[model samples]
Target: MNDAIHSSKAPEPVGLYPHARRVGNLLFLSGVGPRQRGSRDIPGVTLNAQGEIVDYDIATQCRSVFDNVRNILEECGSSWERLVDVTVFLTNMKADFKTYNAIYADYFRDNQPARTTVEVLSLPTPIAIELKCIATID
Candidate 1:
């Protein structure tokens, strides 16, 4: 059976899904964006009235996305060291990979988890990046 885990420290899910779910010892995190918890504001993003991205800083968005993921990890009784895999989505891979990779390295450092980064046309929100992770509790 699957169990949902919600973190009060993270932003409310923009969609119907819960923040993360666990099946046995493995926890699967939903795609987490850069939205702030109370304000719902996306850091480093500037959107037009139509909700299209005008300007964005991938570094800022990257940090917030990871922060959200970290919050989920903590709330789920896991830790960064427990992360087994990570999948990252970026709206602009060519333009943003360097900065995002740098910040990511800072976080993971020597305990790097298996990772994949992909470029997408857009996300549900106007943010530049999102992260999904799988971690083990035992």
Candidate 2:
């Protein structure tokens, strides 16, 4: 059986989908972004009048994305240590990868889950980064 999960403390998803879904012991998270809970504000990001990204601090976005992922995992009965895999999406890998990787090391030092980071032209929102994750819940 599959169970859809929502997190009140985490940012609402940009689209019409649950934050995560549980199939038996495995939990699959939707692509999680750095938007803060209850608002569209993205940390370290500046949007122009047209809502296009003006500038962004990848390090800040990386931390916020990590925190958002963790909140969803904890809300859905999993945790950072329980994560089995992560897929990262960045709008600018060349400019952000080194900073993102350094911060990622800080967060995943003890529990390093399998990870893949990629560059994308854009995301649904003006945010610079997002994360998709899989974890086991006991």
Who wins the lDDT comparison? 2
- Give a tens-digit lDDT track for model 1, residues 1-138: 589988898888888988999999999999999999998468998878887778888888888888888888999899888999999998888999999999999999967899999999988877888898999985
User: What are the per-residue Cα lDDT tens digits for candidate 2 across 15-111?
Assistant: 8999999999999999999989978779999999999888899989899999999999998989999999999999999999999999999999999
Model 2 steric clash pairs: none
Q: lDDT of all predictions, in order shown?
A: 0.89, 0.92
Record all residue pairs in model 1 with backbone atoms less than 3 Å apart, i.e. clashing.
Answer: none
Q: Once superposed on the true structure, which residue ranges of model 1 sit more than 4 Å away at CA?
A: none
TM-score to native of every candidate shown: 0.94, 0.98
- Give me the overall lDDT of model 2: 0.92
